[model samples]
Target: MSLCEIVRLEGYIQSSYLAVYPDKIMLLDGCCRADVPMVLDYIKTTLKRPVTDLKVVVVTHMHPDHAGGAHKFREETGCLIVSADKKKQWYSGIGGRTMHFVDIHLGYYVARRQGRPLKNLYYSASL
Candidate 1:
């Protein structure tokens, strides 16, 4: 049988799961944009693996803490982002863009409430 280990990496506002195998890795969630460096470091330092081993990133939702780092991950590791195929984009029009901005601030509020230090959480509304 093949062996795979799932490790939980604590992010600025949420936790992300990494499924590690001999030749591949998968992120269960996108995590916060502030967390990209931390997650990449963990994979390279702790897991002793190349960043390219990260093959897939599954975004559970459009929330800042859930999909914020997806584009960064793809840009860094060429990982495929998997999410629900919706008929309409969540952040489409001007109002939707405003909501996206509000959501990012809300993420910062949550991090502050959790006693976490402020970090850059800005991400493109269009995924």
Candidate 2:
């Protein structure tokens, strides 16, 4: 798998793109709740590299930073985004589901499990 970092637009969010194969790619985190183009530029460049073809965008859960770029990426790259089911509904503009948020403790736990320091914890919802 290959990973790429795409910084979000100022006052926006951050994102990461993962390419599992030359013909497949999944977006780990998205730029923000709305549209953010800088992140898009990052991914496009990465795909253009004669390396990998980004085909899918997957998010770990809901939240703008992780879920925001799904639609745009799909439109731009013709990539399909697979997100946590609950989040998928939200992005479809048919919002009527229970909204739950992530906690810092769980975040810390995840970081620890990854052998990362808790204080250095950061997340891109698109994991």
Measured on C-alpha atoms, candidate 1 has an lDDT of 0.92
Residue 59 shift from truth in candidate 2, angstroms: 1.4
Compared with the true structure, all predictions reach lDDT values of 0.92, 0.48
Per-residue lDDT over 1-127 for candidate 1, one digit per residue giving the tens place of the 0 to 100 score: 2548889988888889998989999999899999999999999999888999999999988889999999999999999999999888789899899999999999989999999888998998977
Local error of candidate 1 at 68, Å? 0.5
TM-score of predicted structure 1: 0.94
RMSD of 2: 9.3
Q: Tell me which residue pairs clash in candidate 1.
A: none
* Best candidate, TM-score: 1
